[model samples]
Every structure is written in structure tokens, then in C-alpha cells.
Target: MDPVKRHLPPLKTSINKYNLHAKKSLGQHFLLDPMINQQIIALAGDIKNKTLVEVGPGPGGLTRALLDSPARCVIGVEVDQRALLLLNELKEYYPERFKIVEHDALKLDLTTLCDSPRQIISNLPYNIGTTLFLGWLKQGAAWDRMTLMFQQEVAERICAAPNTEFYGRLSVIAQWVANCAIVKRIPPGAFSPPPKVYSAVVNVVPKSEQPSPILFKAMETVTAAAFGQRRKMLKGALKTIDGVNLLAKANIDGTRRAETLNISEFDQLARLYAQNNNL
Candidate 1:
């Protein structure tokens, strides 16, 4: 039997019984659109034999979609007590495939959660979306891929190119170690209690070997300083980093703003900083 069709009854009943109202404090927004739910699942691609780790499975909407997929196992880390109750019922219906951990996703150690060749698929809480992505990236080749939903603006920043308004610390950091692409755009209405802004689904596949840690650290420091005062020129903004000598070391036009630099330019600046610090 199709898992979605078989488990639909329990999902509906659990929702009602638990009074699983979306909590604003948790940045909860249940996705009620079945089509969108299935679409996001499809984006996960070739789930067969793959393990999936999902965050914030509010009302088990996306959880249902994952259950219906060919995935070997679906583990959800949910913080909401009401949603956790509903998730427990789903576990009962699909004992072999469903597992719910009642804990904050942000605090969980993803490296210890599942073995390699896993994937993270979630409509993440907006408040912690970027923080979670950064954490996953720092894990250094932990998962096979990440299919995530973020605010449209954040989605653009992840996939943004050089010199674009959306390009900044996020673009540099994400591009340094992974290939990012916006798979699809979902309208605001697709979500229950639709968010004021549109949302987008993004796919991220990490690189085989990431750039030097020293370079990453330098890039973080440089971008933080540059974008922190985005209006200022690169030379002025980067002066805070010792031994930077921005223009002479990076060969970048000092007159240009931070947004004007491409990934390569940032890489050059990072390399320069690292060399200066012997990092």
C-alpha cells in the first residue's frame, strides 16, 4: 500500500487530537499543500536506500511525503511538543521507516545522527535556517545532499553570483565548499498561515574536498567586516584585519564595494590574509 494513502487517516486524526497549532515562537508554518509537499519530496531525488533527516516536521505534512518516498528510513527531529505527539503516531503506523527524536534540531549533532550517504530534507524554521546551513557546511562532507526551503531572499543569496545585490557572506561561504542551486519557487499561499514572503526550495551538494580552513576563516572575517559596513570601500572595511594591506595583497580595486567582489576575489583576499598570518 502507498504510505501516503495508508497513513493519511492517522495524520489527520493526530492533527485534530493534539490541537497542533503552528507556533510563531518556533517559526512554525505547516505546509498543507499536498502537491507542494510531494514536489519537495521529488526534489530529494532517488531516495531509495537513502536515509533522510528532517527538521521541524510540523503536523507531519512533509513527513508524510518522505514516508511515501522510497527512502530506507525517515528520521525527524522536531521541537514542538504537539507536533512530536503527532509524529509518534506516524511512527506507530510506519514502524520500520519512521523515527522521531523529540529535541531541538539546532542542538542536535548531525554527524552522530546517521552514517554517511544521508540527506537532509526540510522546510526549516526561518529563524534558524541560515544558522543550520552554516553548521551543516562546517561538518565537511557529512551528507550526500541537502534539499531545504528558505525565504526567497535567502534562497537567492545562496545561489547568487558575483556583483549581485544578493551576494554577500552567505554566497561566499556556501560557494566555498558546495554547489548551490534554487530548485523551485513556492508561492506564499502554499504554506498554512502563509508567510508574508515567498519561499524557495534549494539543493546543496558539498564539494569532495573543501577549501583550506584558514581560507574559510579569513573569508569569514573579511566578509563580516566588509559587509558589516557594506557602504564602505573594500580597503577601508578590510583595514581592521592585521597585515591585510587589502589592495596590495589582493590586487582588488580598493574603490570597489564588498558586493562588487566575486568568489575568486574573496578567495584571493582570504589567501592573502592566510599567508600574512601564516595560518
Candidate 2:
């Protein structure tokens, strides 16, 4: 019997009893589509013996699927107290396989939560999803893989290439540290109380070694400045930074706009900024 099927009765009962409704303020759009949930688990691949961490597991739909997978253990971090009761029930049914930590996922120490070779699989809350991902990246190659679902727009930003409108700071930073791509796109209707925008699942595998730390910092600073005034040319946008002789020092055309520059150009500017201090 499928683990999820076996637990269906209790799961449904809890939802009915609690009258648990997805909370928009929490960015909760519960995924009622089992097939889609299963597909997400499949994308993660061979969870058997792997530890999976799920965030905002409202009513454990994905949590149930994770248990059905080869995963040896599953940990769910949820902020909704109403969801906690249902998660706790699932934990009891699969004592050795499931664990629930009732807390805001963003506030928790994810690295210390499990042993190495950890994988994160979550249909994250839309509001904090990007912020949470940036936090994970900063951990410096903590997880084996991260299969996360996010608002389609944000997903596009992560997978977008330079020269595209979607490409920006997120694309640069994420691609610099991880091999990222959108695995699937989900329609808004796939979720309960359907969200206004579609969602996409993205797979991010951390690299063995990252770019120079100094370059990374500079890239961030430069991108923030450049993109902040996205419509403006580099000459005007980067003028705030001292010694920012856009065309000569950065090797970037002063006439070009922020969106026109690629990751390499950004890195070049970053390296120059770090060395010159004046720029």
C-alpha cells in the first residue's frame, strides 16, 4: 500500500475537523493535486536513505509524498499552528520516518537540523520563498540538492540568462553558486484556492567551489546599484561609487544599460571595484 493512501483517512479527517483553510497572508496555497505532488517528489529522486526538509507543509500533502518516496526521514517546518496538529498526527503514524518542527522556517537553523547529504523539498510560502533561498545559498553548499517551488516570476529570475529582462541579481548570485534550472511549471489552478500567478519548480545543485569571495561581494554591490537604476546607462547608474569610471575601469560601455550586462561583465566590474576602492 502506498504510504500516502494508508494515511489518507486520518489526513482528511484532520482537515475536516480543523476546518483548515489556506491563509493568504501566510502565502499559503495548498497543493491539492497529488499527481503534481508526486511529480515533485520524483524530481528530487531516490530519497531513500536521504533526509528531506520541507517548509510550510500545510496538511502534509507533499509531506505524505516524501514519506512514500525512498526517503529515510522527512522533516517539516511549519509556522501555522493549525497545520501543526495534522503534521503531528502524520509524525505519529510514521514515527521513524516523519518529524515536525513547529516554527517559522526562516527563523530556524536549517544547517544544524540534519546531518550532511541533506536535500530540501518544499512548496515554500510565496512571500518569503526568495528570501529563504538566498539564506540557504549563503550557507555555502549546505544541501545536496534543493527542489523548491516558487512564484513563476521569481523562478524565471533564477533560471534567466543574461541579456533577458528576467535576468538580474538573483540569476547572477544563484547561478554563481549553484547549477539552477526550472524543472517544471505549475498552473495556478493546481493549488487550492488558486493563486493569482503560476508557480514553477526549480532545481538548484550547489557547486563544489564558488567564485572569489571578493568578486561575489562586488557583484552584489554593483548589481544592486546598477539594477536599482535599471533604465539608466552604466555611466549614470554607477556614478555613485567613487572612481567608477564606467567605460575605462570596468571595461563596460558607458552607453549600455544595466540589463545588457552579463554575469562575466558583472564579475569584471566587481573585481575592479574591489581593487580600486575608488570605484
Candidate 3:
């Protein structure tokens, strides 16, 4: 059957049959619109014959989208018991093409979730989405691509530019390692029990030249210090931080605020800090 034309039960009906309700504490918001889900999957570019990992496959709404794609297989990491039976039904439907790992996505190493050459695609749990992405950014380039959904504000921070209100540690680190962009802005109505805020799908591809885990940590340290006092001048913000002296050493202006510095400049700071501290 053609992926686009494949016959599958409606996601809403499955949710009803499984006695599933979106958990407020878990930050669950099912993207129950089939076409919207399909569009989200397409943002990953191409998966043909590769495995796709989904972080929170609530109600299998987006799971259906992944299965309907030409991807060779889909592995969903889920913690909700309410979703297991419904996902099991999906597994039966796509016996050769689907698998489910019953566990908390945040507790497991995503790289170990499957073999190499995998790509991650999911409507991530809003609460842990940033935390998970930060981990993925630190890990080796285990996956080819990652297409994820995050709260619109989170998405903005991930893709925000220097000097913008949304830009912070997230913008610097994510931009340092990968090409980040928000490909779609989704309305609240797109989800079941719609959230108060809108959502967006982000596409991130790792750069060929990337930071080592140690260097990445250095960057994290500096950004935390710099943005921790975001409104203060760089000299004041980083005075107690190791990277402060590097401003004069690297010819960076001490009068500028943290948000005024770009990714490359932050890299310079991280590198300088790492070298001096013998990290």
C-alpha cells in the first residue's frame, strides 16, 4: 500500500477505544489531525529505509504519521500505560515496520535506543523537550536529522538570533552544533485538548564540524554565566566567571551585554575558558 494512501483507523477512535486521556502533568497534547501529522513528518526531509525514533507517542497520532511514511521502521519510547495497548495495536498493523520501547524517554540514552543511521522525529513532551534536545546536542552525531515539535516559545529560543529576547543559552549551543530552524508554526487547534500556547516544528541537522563534549560543556558554562545575568554588561555578567578576562584577551568589548554576542563569539569565549581552566 502506498504510504500516502494507506488505510489506518482514525487516531481519535483509537484514543477513545484505549481509554486514553492526555495527562496534564505529562505535558501531553496529541496532534490528532492526520494531515497535520503527515505534514510534520514530511519536514524531516527524507527517511526512506531508515529508522525513525519518536519520543512521546501519545495516542499514536503522530505514530500513525511515522508508520505511514516510507521509513523502514519506527521505534516509539513511551511512558504512558494508557497508550501501550493502542500502540500495540499499531505494532500489529505494521508488524514489520514498528516497535515500542516502554520507558521514559528522558531516562534512556537515545543513541542506545536503536542502531546507527536513525533519525528522530516526534511531538516531544513539552516539559522535557529542551532537556532532551540539550542531551542530543551533547552526544555524538548518532542521528542524521531531528524533526521535533516544541512549544512555540521553546522553538523560538532554539532558533532565536543574538540580541533577541528569545535568544539565550539554547540559541547559542543549538546554533553552535547544528543548523536550526522552525519550519512550521502550528495553531493550538491542531492538537486535542489544545494547549494555551501555539506550537512549532523544528528541524535541526548537525554540522560537520562540531564541538567535543568537553568543549560543549565549556560553552554551557559560559552561556549559563553570561545569560544568568543577561541584562548586565559582559564584564559585569562574567566578572565572577572564568571567561570574563578573555574579553580583553580576545578583543571582545566588555561593555556589550550577553545577548549582543553571537555564536562564534560565544565559541571564542568557551574555547578561551576551556584552555585557561585546563578543561
User: Per-residue lDDT of 1-279 in model 2, one digit per residue for the tens?
Assistant: 856566556556777777888998999999867799999988876677989999999988888888878887998999898999888877777888888887887788887778977999999999999999988877656788999999999999999997897988899888878889899999989888899999999999989986665666777787788888778888888888642574577666787887787777777787788777742
Cα TM-score of candidate 2 = 0.91
Model 2 lDDT, full chain set: 0.84
TM-scores of the candidates are 0.94, 0.91, 0.96
Q: Rate residue 228 of model 3 by lDDT.
A: 97
Each candidate: RMSD to true structure? Answer: 1.8, 2.3, 1.8
- Candidate with better TM-score, 1 vs 3: 3
Off by over 4 Å in 2: 2-10, 211-215, 277-279
Segments of candidate 1 deviating more than 4 angstroms: 2-4, 7-10
How much is 272 displaced in model 1, in angstroms? 2.3
Q: Which pairs clash in the backbone of model 1?
A: none
lDDT of 3 by residue, 167-245 (tens): 9999999999999999999999888789999999999999888788889999999999999988898898888774557
Question: Which candidate's lDDT is highest?
Answer: 3
